[model samples]
Target: MTIATHIPLPQPLASLRRRAPGTVAGVDWALLSDSEARRLREFGLDEGVEVELLHAGRFGSGPVAARIGRMTVTFRRHIARAIHVQPV
Candidate 1:
């Protein structure tokens, strides 16, 4: 018999600054302010969406840019921390 074990690969986008791009797994809405959540939603950042981490500022603590769909969006590191992604 053969068995498979599924391991969770989702991680915060901010933590993936040095890693490869991934798909949007989920958002930690509870960690974000109402405005932040709304803004992210407006940017089309949701589960199942493909995302690519383009760049980050010093020490990966500054603004982060991610390419989603046909557009590229830049946001603060804290906001990126609230987004979870599954590496592709």
Candidate 2:
């Protein structure tokens, strides 16, 4: 017989500043408005997608940028907070 183990590796994107890159786990839709959610979906921010933090706002008080696939997307800090990512 063979045994296998599963471990948890999910985290909020907002909490991953300056850390390792990760895959998009999920998004807290409840925390975002309809338009905001729609915009993010349009930008390809979905589960199983790869995302990396590129740059943060000045003193961490403005918008943030991240690399998603071949495109780079920028949004408010709050939006990043709503995104769940699993470190890669």
Candidate 3:
């Protein structure tokens, strides 16, 4: 018989997928992932990140574009949902 030590198991459910390349029409500043959150923090994509819908992809699934920090980023619907943003 072998003795076992109690160790907290990592929660797989909460783990999010890495960001992929895509475009969003007007991703609200209310959706981003943990890594994305960290990446955005420096770019003003944080809680105070400004948001504006530059244009929409004809189908509305857009390639939404927004201005965060000093850079402009575009993302699609699926990828956008993965990125959690918040209002300033």
Per lDDT, the best of the predicted structures is 1
Candidate 3, poorest ten consecutive residues by summed lDDT: 9-18
lDDT of 1 by residue, 1-88 (tens): 9899886589888777553768999999998999999999998889999888888788767899888887888889889888999988
lDDT scores of the candidates, listed in order: 0.85, 0.83, 0.42
What global local distance difference test value does model 2 have? 0.83
Off by over 4 Å in 2: 1-8, 17-19
The window of 10 residues in a row where model 2 has the poorest summed lDDT is 11-20
Against the true structure, candidate 2 reaches a TM-score of 0.81
C-alpha TM-scores of all predictions: 0.84, 0.81, 0.39
> What tens digits encode model 3's per-residue C-alpha lDDT throughout 1-88?
9999774322111121222222222333446566655554555443333444344355535565654435667655544455444322
Per-model C-alpha RMSD: 2.1, 2.9, 13.4
Check candidate 1 and list the clashing pairs: none
CA-RMSD of model 3 = 13.4
Q: Could you say which candidate leads in TM-score?
A: 1
Error of 1 at 9 (Å): 1.1
